[model samples]
Target: MLIVTTLIACILAVLFIRLSFGVIRLRRQYRVGLGSGGVDDLERAIRAQANFAEYVPIALILMACLELNGAPLWLIAILGIAFVAGRLIHAKGINQPPPHFSNRVIGMKFTITTLIVLVVFNLAWLLLQLWK
Candidate 1:
């Protein structure tokens, strides 16, 4: 479980770094001069960062719980990878034009499925612990 948590944390760290760099690149590209482009880029960066911050912690917490609850290590690994992949896809989709379902849908569903797994694992763990 600790291993899984560490792995997930590392992956998240990398994702955040990439996200920051992406925002910086966007700002540098669009905000080349004194104009609205810079402001728009900043707005987009803030929204992206805010959205990621809002969801990541919850996902991490649940993922940690799942790991601690004796969920299969493979599941943990797969979920961890899926989480990062989904975030990346979602990011790419959002950074582009309209109708970004291809990535967003997969990411959203992956996250939702992980949440459900966490819930089930935690409840089962609690029940087992209480049964003794």
Candidate 2:
């Protein structure tokens, strides 16, 4: 279980680093130090990166807790994979030169679906324990 969580963490960390690279590249390209310099492209890149950073931690924490609480391995793996896939899809969509319509929608769809599943499963599992 720990291995599962750690592996996902590593994968997510790689994604995070990749996003960071995008930020760094854009910052250098635009010659801006701290802000997006009123650049929509840069802003989108930053948001794409920031969005990933925002969502992944909660997802990972929930996943780890679910694992620690003895959630089924298959469920954890499925959700973990789905979440990562969603993030990857989202990053690609948002970082594209222009709006990437389908992938963007699908990416967010995957993300929302995964979150709902994880939350429902965790809550139900916890309540089952309490009921027991």
Candidate 3:
């Protein structure tokens, strides 16, 4: 059931682990065990990690469910790629010492676009299935 989802999940997991490493590296550098310790760079790292944690799971779950429900392979791949690119770009942007607005904005744009597409596509598919 999760064949395609599993494939996408692996790619996402790599990205997630990378983000986790960035957070861990920053944490050790700042010597803070919990929270940001009032360090802005550490805070930004934490935020980037937190932001990814908040968004990627929901997108992945939606993608996995859609694939299980028989969504097209191409659709799943496209969405998965876009979602990953979004997070990568977002993390790269926000991981900067002072935070880069352009990258962050573009990254968020991709994320929101992916989410909207997933929500609409999944809901429409579900409704069509119910109609049948």
Candidate 4:
């Protein structure tokens, strides 16, 4: 069972819904149907949602693979937690004004680090299986 991945995916799903609704709310407020309507907040909201959509699926896939391949439960939990926390921080940072760049940087660091680790771990596991 993909317990860790399931939990992480659920959390990500909720965050995604929140980000999506944020875009919708901004669109309604700005009266733009197709784009940000030249509104900065709306633009930020759109990008936040778009960025989340762009990064999450593959992360979840990698995480699920790790779990399915019998990676350590603790490692999976840590990675999942880091990814979720990173996404939350990034969403908050991206939605804020320009002064909060650190949040974005830190968040991306966590997210990217998690991805790299997942990739390495998955690759190592696959190689080990092949060698066996």
Candidate 5:
């Protein structure tokens, strides 16, 4: 749980750094009034933050529950790392130009992986308890 917590903190840190870069770019893009990417960047940043806030808490809660239900700590750590990596990939994808959607593809992979990990952990816990 502690490792997961730490990893989540790291994800937040990484997100902040990436968000700062985006914001800076947005500011420059809108220096005169508002350019094409300016509003898009602002919207993207806001939506990204909101989306992170919405999903991350639930992910953390699920991870914590798994821990409480006797899931291996190492598994939790791995999932946490996956979540962070997915977000990093997502950020990269968002920042890149067209045809370079690597970040988005990676982000989706990570997100799906994290979700699967959480589901499997919960289901395993349920089966273990039932068998006991």
Candidate 6:
């Protein structure tokens, strides 16, 4: 069972829903049906949600694979927590006005780092299994 991945996915789903609502609220406020309607806040909100959508699926997949392959639960939990923290921080940073670079940078660093670690772990596991 992908317990860690499932929990992480649920948390991410809720965050995604929150981000979606943010976009919906912005759209309603700006009164635009399609696109951002030339509104900066709407554009940011849209991108924040879209960005989350873009990054999360693959992360979850890799995490699930790691868990299924018998990766340590503690490691899985750490990576999952880091990824979630990254997304939340990134969303918060992107949703803010000007000078939000630091949070965005730090968030991406965490996200990318987690991804790299997962990829390495998965590949290593695969290689180990193949050799065995």
> Order of all candidates by TM-score, from best down to worst?
6, 4, 2, 3, 1, 5
lDDT of 3: 0.89
- Those runs of model 6 whose alpha carbons end farther than 4 Å from true positions after fitting are none
| Count of clashes in candidate 3 | 0
Query: How much is 70 displaced in model 5, in angstroms?
Result: 1.8
Q: What C-alpha lDDT do the candidate models reach, one value each?
A: 0.70, 0.89, 0.89, 0.92, 0.70, 0.94
Clashes of each: 0, 0, 0, 0, 1, 0
TM-score of each: 0.75, 0.94, 0.93, 0.95, 0.72, 0.96
Native-to-model Cα distance after best TM-score fit, residue 101 in candidate 1, in Å = 3.1
Write one digit per residue (lDDT tens) for candidate 2, span 1-132. 476778988999999998999888989999989879998888888999898988898898888888988888888999999999999999899988886978888888998899888899999989888898
- Compose the digit string of candidate 4's lDDT tens values, residues 5-123: 99999999999999999999989988999988899999999988998998899999999999999889899999999999999999999999763789988889989999999999999
Output the worst ten-in-a-row residue range by lDDT, candidate 4: 97-106
lDDT of 5 at 56: 69
Residue clash pairs of candidate 6: none
Candidate 1 off by > 4 Å: 32-45
Q: Could you say which candidate leads in TM-score?
A: 6
- What RMSD does each model have against the real structure? 3.4, 1.2, 1.2, 1.1, 3.5, 0.9
Could you give me the TM-score of model 1 versus the true structure? 0.75
Name the regions of candidate 2 deviating beyond 4 angstroms.
none
The sequence of per-residue lDDT tens digits that candidate 1 reaches over residues 17-119 is 7777767777677764333364655555555555676777877887787777676788778777877776776666665555366767776777667667667
Candidate no. 6 TM-score: 0.96
lDDT of 4: 0.92
